[model samples]
Target: MEKCWDLNQLYLSFDDPQFSKDIKTLEKRLEDMKSIPCQDVHEDNLKSYLEQFNQFQDLVEKIYAFISLTMSSDTTNQDALKYSSVIETLLASFADTQARIDRWIGQFDLSQIQDSYIQEHMYVLQEIQENNHHLLSDEGEKVLAQMKTTGSSAWLKYKDQLISSMKVSMDGKDYPLTEVLNMAYSKDKDVRKKAYEAELAAYSQVEQGVASALNAIKGEAITVTQLRGYDSVLQRTLIDSRMSQKTLDVLLETMKKALPIFERYYRLKAEHLGYFQGLPWYELYAPVVESHESYPFEKGSQFVIEQFYSFSKHLGDYAKKAVEQHWIDIYPRVGKVGGAFCHNLHCIGESRFLLNYGNEFGDTVTLGHELGHGFHGECLNQQTALNADYPMPIAETASTFCETIIKNAALKSADSTQKLFILENELCDCAQVIVDIYSRFLFESRLIERRQKGPLSVEEIKDLMLEAQKEAYGQGLDHRYLHPYMWTWKPHYYEADYAFYNFPYAFGLLLAKGLYALYQQQGPSFSEIYEKFLSLTGQMSLEDVGKSVGIDLQDAHFWQNSIDMIKDDIDLFEELLKQNS
Candidate 1:
């Protein structure tokens, strides 16, 4: 009857004997790596060095993943926080020690190291070479590592604290911002509007602290990018993401062109919701027609598994296993987080799902979505630890693809009323991921540009947000109901770890659609291709990775094909609206 997940499956606790032993072993191995003298490292020593480095990296990844995943599930865990901080300190020390070796390695002739493992380690060697200029002497790197604890990292934590403690009151009841915000999905229109207003108003209380955090994080990020000889923050992110701005540029262009198609869907929604001018922001999520049905846990579980089996027996079987093995934590309770997520326990080759299942038709789809993510990781479990983590674009591909299977199945099975609701949910999510996300991309691009001139004021940020909404939304949302507090609550804006984090979503959605389209054409044969594309995402360049499935990333046509698929949906949505209106 546990409503939330139990991490004892991953570790009894961070202080568990096994976890403690791993931490000790990890530290000792890192120190051992650092003990190798710079002069002693040569081409002949390459094999030994790699064997040691891989072991150290593997352990570090395992330990960090365990602690971080635990904290995300329940950030209130003090032991998890302590472990994260301790591991971070360990990583910095490891990096500092490796810096000395890297500098020496950079000076050595890499051609002399002929082993395939050494050759593949070129990425590490290349990174060291690229960073050699900014890397201070070993002593300086060690010292800077200490300063960063109080620098950008501290600012990030402070911002997290500021937001987490925020409260908003509505109709004389004080509620956490998360709870108040969830009211937007209520069946009552008045509640959604009032919640929207309160949510916007509550943001002003912490605007200054949040703005300061954005400034500190991005400011340090910009400085570090320049200091490390990066062309820009965008470039650094792409390098880390294994994606290119060129691919993103193609994706953005496709997004711009696809807006009008979505505008039509919004127009239809406005007509349905009784909007005279346009659909209001609060009403963007308004219920047009209800599916008016619910599925209890057992039946809902069977439906998803049964529908998924039609696509491929492998996928269906996987969903069956997820439900049967108690891999999912279903049902909502107080103190549990609001959103659903799927965390892959790669070491054990399983996944844990956290859901606030309400037995609504939408809840069934949410189950489908998270289970889809679990299957994505299941596909990856066969990969080496290093290859299991994919970049952002492909990360959502499998999940979204799985969702499509469930939704499409429901689409075919439902009565017209139910079908309308199911399709509206799909279209609404698509619209947000496409249209609203496009607006965010525009806002962040201009924000970064403006931030370079000086720190943006609260007024200026609002103005920028509104401008982006106008362009992306066009005639869809009423000017009177736009959300300017968007940048305030979206955690993506504050993290300099990735800039322009908006477009990967549009990329993933469109890419998945295109992939889904191919699957529809080829039938069961497409699953093999889909699985191959997913497998290659970790090691290959975005374009090269895509090429495995015959996708050309730089070509606007590939994106256009995906955009056209959505337009087809927009047309169907309008046709259905007419039938029901």
Candidate 2:
């Protein structure tokens, strides 16, 4: 297998004639669209303007997908980084462009767009109005947007540079931070312990700078949220994510009840690792199985596709196309970034996945995971451009739902040991999304409230973190083992643009589980409803989408029921652990 992605479908080079032509045409379209008079447009003009918007969106998507996917594959590639910078510069004026659209749409009285035919577009119009409050004066918004390149974002880039280049001493040999962090997967216990120490020590080199970056980024978000009249940072996110706070409240409460279950699992693992009192942070991702086997790329790909198809032919077909059609870029090679991500390239009517494929069982799940995202995007292909971008809460619905399918199918088909490994991975990921993510939400919410008083010292931040962990995790984590520096390394905190990014993970997981539960009841025929739900997610409120499938996200019991499903897994895992012992 070639085991790499080819980018020639986009262009051989940015300097290529076709690439230059597309770039010029894109700039020309933006200018052309700006010249069109908005006041003279009636319903027909509004329709025409929206169509042109779709075309512009398509052009920009192709240009961007090419560069971003390339950059992720090789972060150090100078040309890729240059293209990344160029894309940023172009998108910097996004506020200006968006403000123009907002003003144009605002010109139309709601009655004009509320007809039965345009009802589907109500969400799009509502989103614009919701965002309009954040738009400053044209010049002001543009300048502030442009400054982002060298503002908190620049500090973020600096933090990454400092961390990546920093060296750590491990077993008398110094290594880069990336290499040191990978030691968690080592089969040797002593090596894992040493790697943990080395990784922690490496953070010291860039702690202050990263912390300052965090302060600036988070501070900027708080200031802007206040200026925009959002109740809080999380409130702003709820609006952007098309989710309700009530929904979040229910899900958070459910996680609160499930914390002890995850804690029990953690303690069992600790005993296995020969720790009596507390499991150290290094062992958080430690694998317990002794006879580990690696899956080469081919077997891994086949396994994922076969398992997914076993659950649902629609899902299996999409995964197969994703692999066969060059939509996936798999394999661990030099120059690729460390984690995995999927880009739903809506413009090209497809997606691209990037993973540092480590040949672990987890990697198989990851393929199913990213392809699930791609399939979700595929469902949205029927929608208009403006209507196809779903909010964060609903974003993970398909991905997690597909993951559920693979896990359930694997449990049915695998031997006892394989079932244990699969369940462990499922439990591990669920714990992070449910328990760990809740703690992050707690930490960030408190940080925002305290930050309103002004800049917090490092000590104040640590105290806030400690309080948050205690509140969210309860007796689950050994109080001593709770991580304090969590705010420092997690990239979600620095995405100043997207606040309260934590809750959506839980929202996505629980919501996906709820959807999967429905699938179990409805059988294969539920595929039609599932596709409809996915297609509408980009255009409907989270609440509205749930109603399509007889779900009410606002109700606490709906969430409680979904979470209880996970409790079943925990009970089974416990029984198996005890049985094995």
Candidate 3:
């Protein structure tokens, strides 16, 4: 099987004739859209406008996704970078166009629309109307959009460049930052320690630039959110997430209650690592019981396929097709980014995944997580481009649910040591999504609050990061070993548009767990319900989506149930550790 994904399905290369043709076609479409005379909201006017606009959107998605996926796989691809810039500029120029449509749509009492196509898109229409309240005047929106090209957008680009170019010096040799960061998973204590130190040292080269980027991007966000009349950045994020404060309040409260359990797991991990105080940050990712099992690419594929098949034939077949059809770009190369992500191209109805595969068992699980994202795209293929766009929180649901399937299946037949290893891996992830994510949430809240006054010094950013870590990790981590340069590397905090990108991870994991609980009770019959949920993710509010599956997202009891599931795993891990010891 091919190790690299084929983007030929999108275009043979950036120089493809169709690629250029699409750019021209997109320009024409934008011009045509601009020429469409604005009329009073009537069934015909609305339907005609939406039909043309949705088609425009689909083409734009295809063009942008092609450029983005190309850059993600090879960041130094000059053509990809150039085209991405072109597309961003074009889209920024359209901000006023979009705002005008939004304002027009806002004028209509959407409930009065009787057209079938309009009825089909009621949710999208309603969302546009809702967001119209927050939009500025045409000139104002255009100015903001143009300024952002240099402001947050440029800063994000700079941050990516800094990280991509960063190299760590270890033992008189240079290693890429991604390779050194991956050493965190190494079983060799010396390697992990040295890598951690080198990693920290490398940050000095880009720390000030990154801090400035953070300050500028967040300051921009604060300015814009207030200009848009949002009470705070978090409130804007919640509105964008289509989630209410009540739901967030309950989820966070439940997470607070469950924090100490993860703390206990952290302490247990510290004990396993032979640390008397707490697990040192360097050893946080250290494997508890080493498993000799290595899953090479083919072996990993087979394992993921088998586990996915056990869930249902449809899911199993989807996994098989994704691998056989060159849907995945597997393995890391120089200049390729670290970590894994699945980008779904709705226009062409295919998803491309980027993975930095090492022959670790966790890599196999990562495959499952990303393919779960692919499966989500598959379920939404039948929907329109606008309707297929799900909110941040629900975005991770299918991926995490698929991850649960793989991990649970792994644990079923494992020996004592393997069980302990698997459980530790699972608990390790949960702790991050639960406890560490809470730290990020706290840190971001404080960062935004502080960024308002003025640009913070590097020391101030590091101090805030450390303070947040102390509060969230509590005594779970040795105070002396906390990572301060974390704010420099994570891309989440740098996005002015997508602020507070941390908590959605927690929300996604917990919601997936809750869904998994339902699957346990309902069994194979749950597959239909699961697919339905995935399909509606783009159309429904998160609360309504949960209600579709009889879940009450605002109920603390529901979130506590998800936490209880993790606690059970922690309990098993402790028992297994004791028995093995």
Candidate 4:
């Protein structure tokens, strides 16, 4: 009912007495955890430790989520920033404690035991044990953890500031970077081109600072991974992501094969824009068929509810409840972060979404996407806190699947022009998640490889970005107009822990597409099984989770089927272009 999300359910404000009480409780619990006779290994000790650890985890997540979510909505909020810093330091200390517990647990063979709690928490404990080989010495981990606050964490804060505060100059006027970026979707060609140019020019002011932050952040990731004995940053990320190299190898290989299809779509878009050579980077987001279809917030919610109900009453109910309960922070304002995300608070059995809504068709799809994530949270809410944490790649599955449901439903009801517009929008999304993401993966791989030697110069970073774009986009984009400073603004690149955040998007998109295709064949019964699949995400490996649903994540054929689905859309888009022309 309200425009902003109700964090009051979590906490009224930072100044809330409860917030302070929890901070003290968390600190005291950290001390209590440290004092646990963890070295004294036995069933009782393990059981007691597990119970205390669960409480500690829930408390810390509640406290930290409140602060982080607050900061995301208001980047300049001093109270949020202060609490965020405090929690970061506390969590770092907490990580050291967790590391020690992990080591102690690793020395035991608790997996052989049949305790109910152990059975319930088998995956969580086993993962810690499996990663014990990579765990640094307690002292080493503590030092690394402390260093990160000043290193990658600080860099992340700095980069967030640079982008949030950045003002793009256009035609002797200034606009927020987000406002300028939104112009790329404008129907006016000059507005898109000018916005692109202004965005590039604006980056010059913060390029040096952003470049330094990236170097520092990535440099720390490289150093920490090496200290932990990881084979590489990517390998470390895959391990943390709970994905296997075999699965990544297959997913990437499929994506590589599908590049030409996306390129064909891009070139067709270019030709439609009257650029025979290729689509200029600026025009990549330009709407192909201008539809005046706009869904205001209320209409958007109703439409999503209807479409989701067509798929499953459960999903429809969740969408209706999220809207009615004020779980979403809709619309954009100064200092709020760009993009959209659903933060699922399993600790509270609730989810909060942030959106930069602009009353466009894409905005409705984004609402579907984020709510899909919330629906995922609803599924996982039934699990204990320890088992509710799904890996990054599988994390995208439900969200993207929800988007597909709504998009397909809309396409079915639209006229020819609106259908063309919707299909083109879908293809554009698939292109980014699949094609552009490939370039980002390449860039990060090379950047990490080279970052091992030393920090990269700004010029070298730009060069790497261009080289990756050229390879991934090929002639789909006019080489001359490619974004060189792409690495600077994308928050994914600056994340120290999640090295290759790029490909997981492609993984989620393709995997969800495959799931959607399965839904098409199986019809209504598929919805029940789909929720079951989401529930297991927190408990199983990506491949095993796919196996549960009769999908082979490691098989090229499985991914290709999803790619072929996109290819069909691309074909339809091209045909639509001709019909419209």
Candidate 5:
């Protein structure tokens, strides 16, 4: 019944005594961690360090999540902002200590470590050893970490502030930018066009500032990656993502080949909508078939629970618990960030989700997607803190897998008109993941290439975006109506550490589709294998994760098969549209 999530599980308030105590504890642990002797590589010493590190991580994650979740729902919360900066500074100060520990661990061959405790964490320890190859000198590591607190971190916060506070004016009234963006799905053509125009106009007020933030963050990423001996930012991202270059190349090549199929779906939608040139960007999310049914929060949540139940009891139970436990922040408000995300708090064995719900069927699908992320977290609960952190590419597996479950279930029960709406919505999402995401990958690749030369101006950034759109979308989008200011608002580009966040969504979608195919072939028994795959994600390479469930990520055929599934959906969508017409 509560619209807002209950943060009482984290803390009653920032001023809660437990919150203060945890901060002090985190500071104390940092000191203890710094005192660990790097010269001693014995099993006992390593075990002790691991114990202390896990404890320190637990305290830090608790404090950080409380502050971040607080700030996410209300960016103006000054206390949350202050504490966030404090926690970041503390973590940055520990970079030298971490670097020393990593270097020390790197010296030992895992086969030589005989202790059971150390062996239990062999995978993560091996990862640390591998990552040590990229570490700078201790002082350099510390300096970079400390500098980033003021550098990329500050810019990211500023960007969030600018976007969160921005308002779009239309029809003599001002609306939160998120509310207007959600209007893209409005059944009324005028509403969609007006919202799109107003949304674009509103960015001008913040475009220059957002552009500056983008340049600073990206420039920092380029410099840092080069310093770490990475050939390019994308290389560093692949290493951090626990993915290989070959895997990425195959995935992208497959998606690139499938782009024409997506473009065809786009052009067909345009024809249905009476746009002869191409689908206007504003009309991208417009509903073609009218559905009398509405998906208010209660109805949507119930639907998600039911559909998840159809998959497995464990998944069904997780959704029910998330809804009943007040773990979701469920509406758009002035200071709330746009879009949706599921933050899995391994420290508390729970996950928190944020959504901008608007009672549309698309919103229901988004709910299913985020809840899928939560289920992934649920599976990882058995692992220790460090072992629970999975790579970005594999991160979307459970969420997108959950999305497939919800969509398939809905399609089976819908009338012909509703089927068209559902099928079209699914195609639109797939296109965004496959087609729009490719455009983003191109834009960011080019953006980084140019940022290395110098900071890109606002106009130059917009031009790069348009160029990428033209190339990726081809004739699928109207050139005149393309969204030029897209870079200004997408939160993905602003994160200095996580460059190339676009491709992972495509990776996840295709991988999930592959896994979903396995589920179809294996039936109810496949649930165990799926859970096992999700559980191992945090501890294994993505290729290994796929292989755990009999899937090969590096093979071109695996990715191509996934794309063909989307192609099948396009065929069904076309047939449904014809029947409706």
Candidate 6:
């Protein structure tokens, strides 16, 4: 019943004696890692280095997750802020050592290694060897790391503070920006319109500051990627994501071909909402059908747990444990970050979720999504720290898969109106992931391209966002009412290392849909295979991971099949809308 998560498992506080001891332990591990001979390629040295690296990563992750999570829920937590910087500095100091070790490992014929432990980590070793092709010199890598602590990293922190502290002025009152944004789903037309206007107006106060941060972070990304010999920021991201450019091209091509189908769904919703021109930006999440059901935290948690259990006991039990153990920090409050994210703390074999729950059916689905991420982490608990880090594209697969489970289950039990509501919700989410995400991809691509020339002014950034929205949404959104300040609030663009973070959501959704289709065909037996797929996510290439489940990542037909699944939902939603009318 607690609204806040317990971080006691990581550490009681920054001042906890164990926290200090761990910091000391981290330093000792760094020293031990530095001692590994860079010239040696023997099994003993390789094994020792891998073990030390894993232990070092585990220590850092444990410390950083606690600090970052604290800051996420309470951005003003000064201790968390301070320790965040301190830890980054320490990690930055390790860059030269890491570069040296990576260079040494890059020299080995990893296939020839016979040790079981090394073989267990062959994929990670292969990645290291591959990425080493772009590795900067030890000193150069160290300098970039040190500079980022003050450059993109500091700008990212500032951007978060600006957004988290922002308040939207509504009818004679101020609300947290997140609370106001969530009002987009309100059934009350006046409330949704006013909240949308207020939210847009509120961004002006921080728009310049946020714009500067974006330019700096993205400018840093451009410089770094160019220095590392990447052709573009997107290329660097694909490499880091362990995805092939061919796969991205095919996925994107399929999405472009399917955009008109989504646009049709949007236009239908607009007509249902009494807007003939197009769906107004504010009405994008508007509920088309009335739903009397209310889902408070407890009810929503139980609903997700039950639905998950319907899939598999292990998954259901994981959700139950997350809720019972206070793994979720629910509800919106001033200083808490907007949006929902599940942070998998592999170091502790647990995950924590942050959600601005508003008691809508959408919020319940969001809970299922985050818990699905937790379940994925649960399946990966047996892997070592180094081997547990999956790529970004695969990151959303489990979460979206869980989301599908929740929506489909709810649809089966709902009355006509409720089914319409649930189906509309699913379609709305898909449109965002596919349609809106495509806009984001375009905006970021253009932004990075422009940022390379110089810093973009606030107006320029807004213009870029609007241009991208128009192109992607086409006739789907009312051009006059489009959200121009989107680039200011989305955290995706500000991360220097994780450029082009938009398409992965689309990837996850389509892939999850494909996997769900497989589950539906195979019945109960597929649960074991699903878990095995999730378990191997950290240890294999994404293509190979898909192969494990009989899904081919490189095939255009596979992605097109997933898009068709959404098209089917759009068809059902259109039918339901006509019946309800």
In model 3, what lDDT does residue 366 have? 96
Clashes of each: 0, 0, 0, 0, 0, 0
Over the stretch 1-581, how does candidate 1's per-residue lDDT look in tens digits?
Answer: 34555556567776689999989998789878877767876665765776777667567766776776666666687887888879877787765776788787778677666777667556556655665775677776677667667777787778778777888878988778877777877889999999989888888789888888787777777876776678888887887677878988888888898888898889889988888788888888888886678888788889999988887787889998888767777886554566789887666777888887888888888888888888788777776555565777677777888788888888887877777888899999999999999999889878887888888888888899999999999998889999988877788876765777877788888888888888999999987887777766766677888899998989999999988877877788887888887
Candidate 6: segments with Cα more than 4 A from true spot: 1-8, 12-16, 73-75, 161-176, 201-204, 330-338, 356-358
Candidate 4 to truth, TM = 0.96
- Number of the candidate with higher TM-score, 1 or 5: 5
lDDT of 4 by residue, 496-545 (tens): 88888888899999999999999999999999999999999988788889
Which candidate should be chosen as best, given lDDT against the real structure? 6
Model 3 lDDT tens row, 1-581: 67788898888988899999999999999888776666676678888888888798889988898888888878899999899879877877888887887888888887777788888889888988888879999999999988888889899999989998988999999998878987998989999999999999899999999998999999999999999998999999998999998999898888888888988999998897789798889998998888978889899889999989888898999999999999999988877877899999888888999999999889999999999999999999999877888999888889999999999988897888988988899989999999989999989999999989999999999999999999999899999999998888787998899899998999999999999999999999999899998999898789998998899998988999999999999899889989877
Q: Model 5 over residues 1-581: C-alpha lDDT tens digits?
A: 88889889889998899999989888889998888888877878888888888777777878899999999999899999899879877887788988988999887778988888788788899989888878999999989987888899999989989997999999999998878987998889999999999999999899999999999999999999989988999999999999999999999999999999988999999999999998999989988889877899999999999988888999999999999999999999988987899999888899999999989888899999999999999998888877888998888889899999988988998999999988988888899999999999999999999998999899999999999999999899999999999898788999999899999999999999999999899898889999999999988888898899888888999999999999999999889889998
Two-way TM-score contest, 3 vs 6, winner: 3
lDDT of each: 0.80, 0.78, 0.90, 0.89, 0.91, 0.91
Best-fitting candidate, measured by TM-score? Answer: 3
Candidates 2 and 3: which is better by lDDT?
3
Per-residue lDDT over 442-486 for candidate 6, one digit per residue giving the tens place of the 0 to 100 score = 999999888888999999999999999999999988888999999
Measure candidate 2: CA RMSD.
2.1
lDDT for model 1: 0.80
Between 1 and 4, whose lDDT is larger?
4
> Roughly what TM-score does model 5 have, to 2 decimal places?
0.94
Candidate 6: C-alpha RMSD to true structure equals 2.3
